[model samples]
Target: MKHALVFVASPDDKPAYREALLMLGRVALSRKLPPPDVLSGWESAQWIYDSVDGELRQEAAAAVAELPVDWALTPVAGRKKKLLVADMDSTIINVECLDELADFAGIKAEIAAITERAMRGDLEFEPALRERVAKLKGLATEALQKTYDERVRLNPGAATLVKTMAANGARCVLVSGGFTFFTERVAEAAGFHASRANTLLEDATALTGLVQEPILGRAAKLDALRSEARALGVSEQDALAIGDGANDLDMIKAAGFGIAYHAKPLVAAEADAKIDHMSLEAALFFQGYRRGEFVS
Candidate 1:
């Protein structure tokens, strides 16, 4: 089947330069394919080669890797997904919300170590999250608002990816193991259709050190993908899931295009796709959308 080799580079890298495109074209030729369809933009490019087998695609992808760019080769069919599911901490935004919350409680190092272990798949997500949140006991409720205001920043291309996909009639959902407080704000900022996350319990003045029961962990993330796909009247194959932690594994595996976005080592190794060197907008390119076609 026909597949696309999508290459993206940061502005400083300029891997979409003329010579790089020429080299990519040559690489396609070496794979016994005609010159590729070059979907070049300011910072990325997509080389659509005709009917290349998976083995050939891998070889072509390896050749392109020598350049300062990231690439993904996927079947042409269903390249344009109708649903977008994403994780919050460390994936959509820069910092782990829990770790930031931990800082407010003066236990950032301890909580962060647990976070690292869980994200790396060395610890169970639900128990790990509960343990971490427990450490934040008695933290002022006001600190939640302050943390969101001062610490949270969207990852590059987050808005572009969500706005572009949602603008194109795709159902964009932010499903995070993080708290609903952050997901609500993030969904609004990034233009997602809806958001779902764990609810952090709090009293009048401070956190109760408890999250609502049945913590939304790895399994729940997958369930969100399935549920969202059902609500959107689409199958799982028409969806794209992106995240950076072990909790994102099931959802990533369930979606048609599961991307590990600057992920932990375990996730990066297992996801169907990965984006280590580019922004979330590269997900659009992975679906064969040209740069000009992006809605935002």
Candidate 2:
């Protein structure tokens, strides 16, 4: 039997698994008697249905194509992901770093505008990152931790996703364009195996207003994937990546399964799977996991 993964994207609507299975069956039967083996997974509000059928693989592949913002079709074994690397801002959590920092700087509206351009692929993320960080100059560095306490919020199902992945023997790595200070705490709370992000420099109990050079951008986010893959004894094909900005392209392209979660148009167009309509748990489908079987 050959495998097929069907993902539905519509962040605003969640479909019932029973109903989705029924509809999928109708779609498959409409092609003739190519009955198949199926595995299922879900997140946010959508369900992913995987079917194995040698006779109808081609037709099934065509049927599910372009039905959503992002979907992945692969041989069942080919789609299984052994590692998951996720972005923190607007991903594992709902807030963007620079936008929140702007709030602290009393220029929330202005910085948020810059952030919008950057996330939408309109502005370069590295330069925008620098400009935003520069604005934070002179703010007490302790504010970083305060931001962690007041603004760093986890998205729905984020904890479930990480804990579930880890329990299943998959390594969960939290990579971010934000900062290591927050990434560290997020890793602990989410039960992540490890994490990487830009370091915010501080001295004398105040903001240094500087990020250590060689910041982690999209390129660096990609490097975290490679680094984690090696640590986990896997190849690029053994990895999965999820993020919501232009900077995530590198890791997404290199991974076995790249997911765009509530992403901008640019990211959704290119990733292996997209899950804007649901929670982070939706990623389990690429790993061949079913909702009932989810560890958490």
Candidate 3:
């Protein structure tokens, strides 16, 4: 029997899902869909939310090889895809928290320069974080909430992605190159199971303008991936890691599937899959989902 990616999605997202399905279908049409239950080179079939009989899928693809057709089906939610890890800054929200904070401090130009370097893998992540955080020492801690209220917006499809993934017995982990203040907030807002990030200095109620010593750098992100995967009892292949910067590379590499979400050039090129010019919903495609079994 042959093995192929079974792409399924939900009806709510059907328009995009349908588009993705037809794309996969085109591939199946090309090779006449490999014979299922018979392992061979060009063997794969794209199916909607059906208990895809390997043999059946191959038959269908080969049966319709000359003509491409759209398979309309909806996903059955809570089917369970576990262990989703995401980066908080640009991936979860529309902007990087530190960059916004820096802008608030009137040092936007300087901090943005450093951020670009860090995101592109040019400069080390920790040092860049430290330098940026140090510039905000005098801002009131209350500014954090105000910023959240003003600009800490979640990305499109973020709520649906996290909620659906979590409902499927998946353990969600938020790992970021940013600080804990922001990571923690994101974790709570998004219903993530756990989160890890560097700590920032807050003396009582005011910003200390510094990250804690021994910052959680790139290696730390990797550790979070491994630990969460182990805890979730899923092999590395079942893991889904998402991020958008250089610091997230190691962690992304450590997971079964690494996604570069609107990332810097370096990260987008290095990740297992790239979510370019698209929302997090694009990540669902790499999972090879169809609309029949994954939507609630």
Candidate 4:
């Protein structure tokens, strides 16, 4: 099978780092393939090769284990996907909305603990979300806007990733277990085509301390990916999904290319690729995007 091993460096890193990575990659592949195709000067590159032994990912990892570069080794056929389904909290955005809301409720530490455990796959995601939101019972509805205005910020390269993909004819959707209050704003802010998330039930003045039934958790996220792909007239293999939590596992595993963005252990273990040392722009590099072609 034909595969492309892509390496990405932090945009802020010195050019020499990627140079060293290219040299290391050349040695690792040992002239089996032509020199890498540079996607961004001293920032990203890809080596296309034929590997029939089926140990491609391991070989690629071993080749750059000592370096600071982040990488993805995937089949080259569907390198550029037609649909992008991304998780909001801690993936597209810098902080977990639920945890930040917990801060306003004066129960941040406690709520954040459940969040950590749930994301790590130590607890069920749906119940965990409910438990966390329940703790915010009676909190003013105004806290939602406060959290959005004061705490939420896009992770580095988030906008570029979404915009570039959308510009190239892909449908980008932000799906989260977090409330729609944040997902709606985040989707618009990040240039996503649409958004889907749980609704936080509230009265005229405050939270009802209860989320709507049939929470959008693991299964729902996967459903979103499938439904969106269907609506786009594409196969599941024509999609890319990314996230950093256990709730994202189903969709991540189901997408043609699934990436774990600074994820918990379980999620990282199952994802097709992971971004640890670089920004979300690494996703574009993995998809063979050139820096010159990026929208932002």
- Per-candidate Cα RMSD to the true structure, in Å, reads 1.7, 4.2, 7.7, 1.5
lDDT (Cα, 0-100) at 23 in candidate 3: 61
Deviation (Å) of 189 in candidate 3? 1.7
lDDT by residue for model 2 (9-32), tens: 343534543344455556656645
Give the poorly placed runs of model 4, Cα more than 4 Å off. Answer: 15-23, 27-31
The local lDDT score (0 to 100) that residue 63 gets in candidate 3 is: 40
Query: Could you tell me the lDDT of residue 99 within candidate 2?
Result: 78
For candidate 4, write residues 1-296 as lDDT tens digits.
77777788865676645664665566546746666788887688777777635566666676677777888888888889999999999999999999999999889999999999999989998888888888989999999999999999999999999999999999999999988999999999999999999999999999988999899999999999999999989999999999999999999999999999999999999999999988999999999988998999
Every model's TM-score: 0.95, 0.83, 0.76, 0.96
Residue 139 Cα positional deviation in candidate 2, in Å, after optimal superposition: 1.0
Off by over 4 Å in 2: 7-23, 33-72
Q: Compute the lDDT for candidate 1.
A: 0.85
Root-mean-square deviation of Cα positions for candidate 1 versus the true structure, in angstroms = 1.7
